[model samples]
Target: MIRTIPKPKKSKRHFLWLLGMKLMISSLLIFFFMSSCTKEGTISLNNTNDNIGAEIADSITVRTATYQLDPLPANGKGIMLVGEMTDEATGNLKASSYFRIGNSAISSVTLPDDAVFDSISLALPYQGYYYGDTSLTQSFTLHQVTEEIKLIDESNAWEEDEKPVFGSGSTLFTNNTFRYDTNPLGAISFKPKPTSKTDTVFVKLNQMFGEDLWTKVKSGSNQVTNSEEFLEYIKGFVLIPSGKTPALTAFPTDSILMNIYYSYTRTADGKKVQENLQMKVDDTTHQFNSLQIDRSQSLLSALKPDAEGELSSDQTKQQVMLQGLSGLVTKIQFPYLHEFVNRNDVIINKAELTIETPPSSHTPYTAPSTLNIMLADEHGVPKSLLTASYETTTQAAYLVNDLSGGTRNSTYTFNLTEYVSNYRGAMEDTKSSLYLTIPVSDLLTKADRLLIAKSDDSLPIKLRILYTKY
Candidate 1:
């Protein structure tokens, strides 16, 4: 030992100092190697909550790092990660969520210690790394290592007035409105009835002449002489049965008949005056088969002495006498024995009368008159079998010249006499309509049959009045 070169001045401080320097150099080399290896491999950082409070560690480990891709890389494309680490590294790292490198699609990466990253980023770098080779890429860091989190409440986010309520099993919403329910019982009921008033007037005239030889007048006065006197005139006569003698009483009470006649006499002015002078009973056809008195009997014979004398004095005197006697004589005569059969069952066939007056008086004066009889049952209803007909006659000269210069010289008549006959056997209903039609041919036939002269011409009528139920 004595011979070991004298151990020149060995000290503790120098030995410790040499040891500290050797340790510092070894640590620096290891750190540099680690940083270079990290760059070659893939640097990853945890963007999760744990990184929020983390200081700059020697390395970085990503547990929840989502990426913000500026221009997302297409499918099958490789993405690159780039940022400065806490260790002061600035090169990009090959790592992505949608794409991966060989054997590290979901692998964990370790970064070098002492790395400080300023702007970290990721992107799709190569093609054919994503499905369909799409161009989607994560190009930026979606979260920072230090960040604060926030929570939101979605309740009451929408206004109450704008919100809608949905019923069970229904997606439709309803608003505020009123609806009504309608059913059969909600319908209204209405009924109609007759509420109109009826206005009508009826008239009946009865006449009597004498007790034993009584005659009832069928036709009423042409004009009302005086309202009081006219009423008395209608009731002046009483009806009586004719004598039983065969020759004296040829007219039977059960038969329906009519009579018509006219006469002419010379007036003081030398004018021939004509008028309805006598009436002779016959069948309903109105034919003059029987006379009230024999035609040969003098009409003056029945007049008073003064009247007879005046009539026999001269032709002119006779005309004056007849004219004055017309008012006293009844134009229509019916014996009391010829009473309407079944008085209670009798029906008024019709009760219409029309008069035609001359606009100006002239020679061959012609005035027309019409009467319609409508037979009805005891209840004032029409009967089917009761019929009636009309006959019109004019003076020969009037027929030849006055009426259209003989163009309308024939007759104008109607046959409605059979419309009501058997009056007792009719329906009881009062609501019945009886239509009366005077066909053109039927009218012409009656006109021809009752024409004053047998001419080959037809007459035109001036007026027609009809009475029937509508």
Candidate 2:
């Protein structure tokens, strides 16, 4: 048997009577609270910069996950010999980059008839950047590319959000290694007092190899006649670390020249005229930096696309990781944030997010210099957060001096007042998650990562909100 439902008709008089009752009740309530009203029917808002006597306040721990970003720029920032590091949160990271430089001379590339190769030195100017411990001496190997290190033409340039693929071109070179102390072992003199971020370094290359190149130039070889032939003859340079240093990054550009020093006896006299031919470095030096991360050793390495507990109620498996060039970020979500859904009359005085690291995490490890909290898509691409007004004005982090030496100052507290206030009705649209990552800098950024505190951690992550329920 089938049953049919009937529609009931509404009367205009009954509707008018119900609306009148509601207005009367509202008027009476307004009159009762008139003493506390700023407007005829609205309560007055008291603003408190700090959390003071909050009428409605609560805290919650959100879920977090690591998000791997796209491939970093191939050769723009500089050279890299990133040492390996393994942590429970950030996984394993090892970045090694390759670069290709060409002859600077336009034409008339010549050598003295009696010029005898004395020595050659690779001079590298500093980029004012370095990572890892300077306590240990490090070694970086230089290789010659057997294949052309061509530039990515605009036609072949990857999309803005596209991650690049890793390429290991067949490069040829005799063994050339640079071994040096990262720090001065004895007294050092500098006209400007060379800082850790500045100064130049030199590595002596094989003189025999330098002579071989000079021989080719004098033999009328195509390699010395033209830039294209030179690039084809001596493809490019690549840096390979010995893996002894914890981590290291070096910036090498065309200015990082190979100076060929030789002496030629003048035909007029028995005098020796010493001249140095410098390999040119200019805008034509096409370069790229590539990062390789081995997640096999990472504690969060097992996370999968369909992994459960990513944002679980218990919060054991969820984690937030941020690394600059390594291309990783963390996604976050406060499931219960809807509790503050439509607080139209409330004033969000303060909303601070405190993230604490576990005891198991490495201490004294240099954290990311800066960070950003923004909305993210399913692909982990970041978007602007209209509510994160203070994200720019506020400092990314502060020094929590632990002079007393306890757990009081080990946490990273981010001011999220403007961000939380922007989300007054944002939940309806952002039903999925937000993200935490290093500020994007058009790939000019460096290698840095931070591991946020998870729920299972001793301190865990908490979002403390202090608002006035006017």
Candidate 3:
């Protein structure tokens, strides 16, 4: 509820140790939320105050209230590579995905004039960066994406809770367990010379598929000439893990491709030699890693959305959940702004939100370096704080830093002054909500999440609003 303050004073970073929050405002909802709110009710509003420059004798009212919000909508997968990983610490989350691969035009132009097919292998250059324990063995299995490896971005089907079905997908490649160890799989990865660190991981595919590919190449088929034609013959590959390991993020098919090894006979002066040939990845085609996340075992899985769009207290009493890829965002609303409207014009000098990381009793995870937020829209789309930089962090809604947290307060704080200012500007029209999340900005389509404290905890989520009423 909106607590009253007598008079006001101020406040004010680019430091890291991210503390996060997000939201927007509309007048109508603000009234409904902020009305009937009272804290101690000690500071009295002046009886004669309808004027512009009314003297505000009392100290500034600082009120804190927490609002529950529905989960955020899924983000469109824009990254290039297929990022798959399961984190036991992060709700037993697992990512299963598939994508189409095409032969590079350069290599596809024509097979060796006198070439014969040998063996085929799928090469995936590891991006080198992984979220969980890379040292641990992560078993992976690749299947033939027999069905068209369609991109889900073209339709709204991806928005649903369940992932899109590759539809009767078939595995051309036999299901084999490829184990990922400290020295992950790659031709160059495990070289004895080991002059440089290996960044690529290779998985040899079924030889018959390569034979089929070579068959088509010998027929002078268009499949060898263009990716569009090649995809028709063999759609793509569906990647899944044998057992759950934290995560394995791979590069795009551009860096990752199916190399069809072949050999040609050459007679050099009286000696015969075997020469090698390869069919590389068509860098033009874009392969995506669409993630289907399983959150049943994670901390946030306990949270179930209520029918009426309300968050369950028991389900989310003490923790703020930021599930990655699966799109679970913490929604927060300021429900006491109407109390400020009832009195008169109040200048919200600074309204900062501080969310503390629940200190771990057993083991503590690394704090997210940067927390991000965006305005929550009723239509399931993202809205902004309506500020100069709502879309970017240049003028973000929330951030946690030592500067704001007194350099030692392990909590993060955000200036909600803009939110309050908009509310006062359009009293009856002010209504909006904030969606909190972990930012994903990679072709690997990978990011870690935050699971901090909520309002019901001993150290409840706080919104400290400093306002001066004139």
Model 2 lDDT-worst window of ten: 185-194
Total backbone clashes of candidate 2, pairs 3 or more residues apart or in separate chains: 7
Can you write out model 2's per-residue Cα lDDT over 91-182, one digit (the tens) per residue? 55555445554566523566778778787766666555555555566555555555665555543443444322221222111111222223
Badly placed stretches (over 4 Å) of model 1 are 1-302, 305-322, 325-328, 336-338, 341-344, 351-470
Candidate 3, superposed: residue stretches over 4 Å from native: 1-90, 106-108, 111-114, 151-197, 226-228, 267-286, 297-299, 302-310, 359-365, 385-409, 428-431, 440-444, 454-460
Give one digit per residue, the lDDT tens place, for model 3 in 30-55: 64334312221222332323332323
Instruction: Score each candidate by Cα lDDT.
Output: 0.20, 0.53, 0.46
Quick one: ranking by lDDT, best first? 2, 3, 1
Tens digits of per-residue lDDT, candidate 1, 1-470, equal 56656667758999999999999999986775444222321222222123212111211111110011011111111111111111000111111111111111101222223222221111111211111111222112211111111111213322333221110111110111111111110111111111212211111111111110111111222212233433233211111112111110111111211111222344456554432212111111111111121112333333332111122112222111111001111011111211331245232232211112122311121222222222323322223222333324311111123365533333323332222222224433332222111221121111110101112321121112121111
Query: What local lDDT does model 3 show for residue 382?
Result: 48
Candidate 2 lDDT (Cα, whole model)? 0.53
